[model samples]
Target: MSGFVVMGITAFAASAYVTLDMSQARPEVHGPAHYGLLVAHIFTGTVAVVAGVSQFWPGLRSRHPRVHRVMGRVYFAAVLPSALLGIVCAQLSFYGLATSGPLTVLSVLWFASAAQGLRTARRRRFGAHRIWMIRGFALTSAAVTGRLWGLLLGGLLPDADGLLVFTTANWLSFVVNLLVAEWWIQSRGYTRALPSEALKPSISSRSAQSSASVA
Candidate 1:
């Protein structure tokens, strides 16, 4: 329920921003090229958010593996392009280094995590794949967290400078989400459960049974 609400709000917000004219964009993204990149970022980023959320649902994966796989593909497809466009946009940010620096780092991490997830999945190391995907999705959620933080800070400190608010929000957005993802992965035992180790016991059990029958 909460996830749905967050996704709905994020989709609406991104759509709204994408529809805005170049002149209405932030000073750093006011030009036509930057505006177009922003639109692509928003569209693909929204697809990532939606696809990522579905990928995490255990019911969907357990009951409908095909759907899960499709969603996984969609998630990666959306994340890669979105992260690339985001890096370019961050580089062109008018908000100066303070704001762009963290976002630039975030874009790199986002792409790397998503790529790692894809790699792990292809290797059939599902536990590792889940961990990496969770990390990627956490970073992707920055768009929503950034806005929430901005709203809170803006209301609390109406006189604060815009750049300061943006900088603080940008840092907290991905950092907090990634930290929480790490914690969740640990709590779920995904980090501890390697595919080889999980198969070892079963293989050893089968060998023991075979030896006993021979005896």
Candidate 2:
């Protein structure tokens, strides 16, 4: 997990360098509006990636509750705006809807997962909250995984169509990530408490009932 976080940060750093430095001579964006949204997307996305990873560090939450809570807030705060801007920027993608469509779908899922995580946390459903947040982080990690996929595929099939590879990676990145998250949840035995179970009598209450029945 730590290795993954480090890889994510490294990828983000490389991308940020190319994005923010004018000397990099990056390809042109559509116009000022598109450029602005893209910039906002990058900034908020960076924040989300940085803060989101810390929330899952093995001992961070239990060892430092205050830091965990603060970073958790920062993660959700950044992710919402990042996802929103990502959708607009996706529509303006130079790669066309082929790439943009998948990206937009990713952003929508990212937003929903983060929102649900926040909602569950507020309702004091910590188990559900952790699961949803894991989903959210998986979606967010697509920024790294998508680039990794692109690089790996592009290298393996140098003659392949660029658009095809890009589109496939965009879809696979988040889809695979979410699938892995579900697997992890199940493997770890993370179960959501049912509404009925929440209302079930406590063990002590059951014991008391047993005594009274015996009497």
Candidate 3:
């Protein structure tokens, strides 16, 4: 459900940026990083969307573990360069147009959580992996949300005042995005969730019988 919203938002964000930064005869901002950020965000977000949607398809996953794993690696690889580009681009954000410092912080945190989540998951800590990955993904959605809010508010404000409103509204996306994640984890009662090891099947002789039935 959340992934659907994320995919739509990210695709919109990418398209919006392409219009704003790339397609314009005269761009609003001509910074080199602006173009780079747009490219990174679009490519990586698209990859994430595809891979993420696959997670919901258990039949596909069951039949194609290799495909699933390959996409997982692609997501991880995409995050790294995208995250680095985000950090670089944050500094060039419009001042009074937005708060660069906080955006930079959010980008850094997003990168760390995502990179660490992938690494930990590879090491077999599935529960921790989900936690960190979810945290990272929540931040990923913020990019999309930020642009949406900025556009919405831009329409309400006068041309002269639109930039400020857009900037302020954009940063709120991160706050709102994280708040949604925290609320979801709490609402699902996963805050006190136990270790993955606790869910392992017991080693009784009857375990073979259970496994046979499942197979």
Candidate 4:
């Protein structure tokens, strides 16, 4: 429910931004070409985020594998193009390399993670695919998390320079999310499972079954 709320709010905000006229867009993106890429990135990115969140829902994947596969396709299709456009938009950012550098790196990471997810899925390595997709989703969610960090920073340091706060928040958003995701995967024992082992019953379960047979 909380995830839905966050995704909804972020989607609403992104959709609103994309709909804004050139005159209403940021000064740096007033040019038609730049604005178009920005809009494209936002729209496709919003789709990716929404789709990615649904992909993580265990019930949906476990009960409706077809839906999961479809959603995964949508996520990859949307995210790959979105990340590419994002790289271009980042390069054109008014904040220059300070902001663009980190954003560009993030875009690259986003594309790589999504591509890795696709590769793993194609190889039928569902466990590795899930982890990579989670990484990709965390990067995608940077759009929301970055703004959140900005808001928190704004509230805490009302007098801080806006650009400085934004740059800091931007870096923290994806970096922190990725770190937390890695920690979650480790804590869940996901990293210890082999690609083939993932879909099989656990050793403990087999042991229990054997003991039951003996009884």
**Model 2 misplaced stretches (Cα beyond 4 Å):** 1-28, 192-215
Error of 4 at 6 (Å): 2.4
Off by over 4 Å in 4: 18-20, 195-215
Query: Which lDDT tens digits does candidate 2 get at residues 20-94?
Result: 554442334876666667777877888888888888886998899999999999999999999999888788888
Listed in order, each prediction's TM-score against the native is 0.87, 0.83, 0.72, 0.87
RMSD of 3: 7.5
- List where candidate 3 sits over 4 angstroms from the true fold: 16-27, 31-34, 56-65, 94-97, 155-160, 196-215
Task: For residues 1-215, write the lDDT of model 1, one tens digit per residue.
Answer: 75797698787677566656666554456577788998888889999999999997889999999999999999999999999998998888766799779899999999999999999999998878989998998998998998899899999999999889989989999999999999998898886676566556687799999999999
Question: In the order shown, what is each candidate's alpha-carbon RMSD?
Answer: 4.3, 4.6, 7.5, 7.0
Q: What is the lDDT of residue 49 in candidate 2?
A: 83
Query: What's model 2's lDDT at 212?
Result: 100
Candidate number that wins on TM-score, 2 or 4: 4
TM-score of 4: 0.87
- The per-prediction tally of clashing pairs is 0, 0, 0, 0
Candidate 3 — worst ten consecutive residues by lDDT sum? Answer: 20-29
* Residue 85 CA displacement from its true place in model 2, Å: 0.4
Give candidate 1 misplaced runs (Cα > 4 Å).
18-20, 195-215
